[model samples]
Target chain A: QQQVKQSPQSLIVQKGGIPIINCAYENTAFDYFPWYQQFPGKGPALLIAIRPDVSEKKEGRFTISFNKSAKQFSLHIMDSQPGDSATYFCAATPAERGGADGLTFGKGTHLIIQP
Target chain B: DVKVTQSSRYLVKRTGEKVFLECVQDMDHENMFWYRQDPGLGLRLIYFSYDVKMKEKGDIPEGYSVSREKKERFSLILESASTNQTSMYLCASSRSRTGRGETQYFGPGTRLLVL
Candidate 1:
């Protein structure tokens, strides 16, 4: 039940389009959900995150929509630009003091925005 | 800003050789994590340390081991390197949180090639 399944392994869009990546988990214990963005030859960076208590979170042009009952979450990029092209990963962790548990990551989605 | 640093940006090792990947964080975060990222497999946790001298095995810890001799350092060891172990290694650190919103800071990552 630790698996976080992600879909649309790859996505292509125009410079001003919206690209969405989706992920689902079966573990009910997960309380924190985060999305990470990784560029070529770089480590993944935290993009945006959401908790099960909140249905949605917006950070700049990035947003996270979470569904508690559906056990799913999604990342939406509004007005995606070429600079936003990167491999995105969805991760989850059970809440712990001092962050004891390591994050469980999805397979990843490769996003490309054409000019 | 939290700074997580890895020992190397790229490494090459022969099969059957022993390898060590080191990570250090300057933020004095209590939690440290080691993960391996592959093309289609995403990021898989190898191990984590909640505190000095305390280590825990993650989801895919079969052929790996970890060391946390100090609060600032964490190491991932491959006793016998294999071709299948080639991947991008990431180290992350996070502060212990009283609430549910904890974010992890990642290093630049080390790319290992086992021949």
Candidate 2:
């Protein structure tokens, strides 16, 4: 049973266009939603995160639109650049402290910003 | 800066051989995890540990085992390597932030090939 599901295995967009990746979860207990970005050789890094209490959060050109009612979240990259072409993963966690096992991650989305 | 380091960036092993992958985290985090990433399978958790000598099995722990002898180190052991186990292995650590959130830090990842 995949706890979290992501759509569009691959995505391509113009250099200045916005690329959106969405994810949905079946577990309503999930409280923390985080997005990670992975380059070619490096590991996935924390790009942005959101909690269920907030509807939306923006940091610079990256924005996370979270809909708690729908149990869905999406990441939007504004003014996408060639540098943003990479793999993106969405993950969720239900742990409040450190007792729980770990996070549940979506498969992934390969995003390409065409220059 | 939180840093998680894996023992090797690339490794190759023969089938039926025992394989060991080590991970170390500089940050004094309470949680550490091991995951295998494939092309379409994304990141699947193998094992996790929250404290020294404490370990838990993740979603996929069929042929894998883990040891947490120290707080900063976690080791994943493959009882017998198989060709299907060839994949990118990633280690991550997370610390509890506030009361309801955690930020996971990942290593550079090790690419393993079992022939």
Q: How would you class the docking of model 2?
A: medium
- For model 1 chain A, where is the 10-residue window of minimal lDDT? A93-102
Report DockQ per prediction, comma-separated.
0.70, 0.58
Q: For each candidate, how many residue pairs have backbone atoms clashing (under 3 Å)?
A: 1, 0
Q: Estimate each model's TM-score.
A: 0.96, 0.97
Give candidate 1 regions above 4 Å deviation.
Answer: B97-99
- Give per-residue CA lDDT, model 2, range B3-115, as digits (tens): 99999999999999999999999988888999999998789999998889998899999999999999999999999999999999999998743456677899999999999
Task: Please state the error at residue B73 of candidate 2 in Å.
Answer: 0.5
The residue pairs that clash in candidate 1, if any, are: A98-B96
Off by over 4 Å in 2: A98-100
Model 2 per-residue lDDT at B21: 99
Model 2 chain B scores worst on lDDT over the 10 consecutive residues at B95-104
Interface RMSD after interface superposition, model 2? 2.3
Alpha-carbon DockQ of candidate 1:
0.70
TM-score of predicted model 1? Answer: 0.96
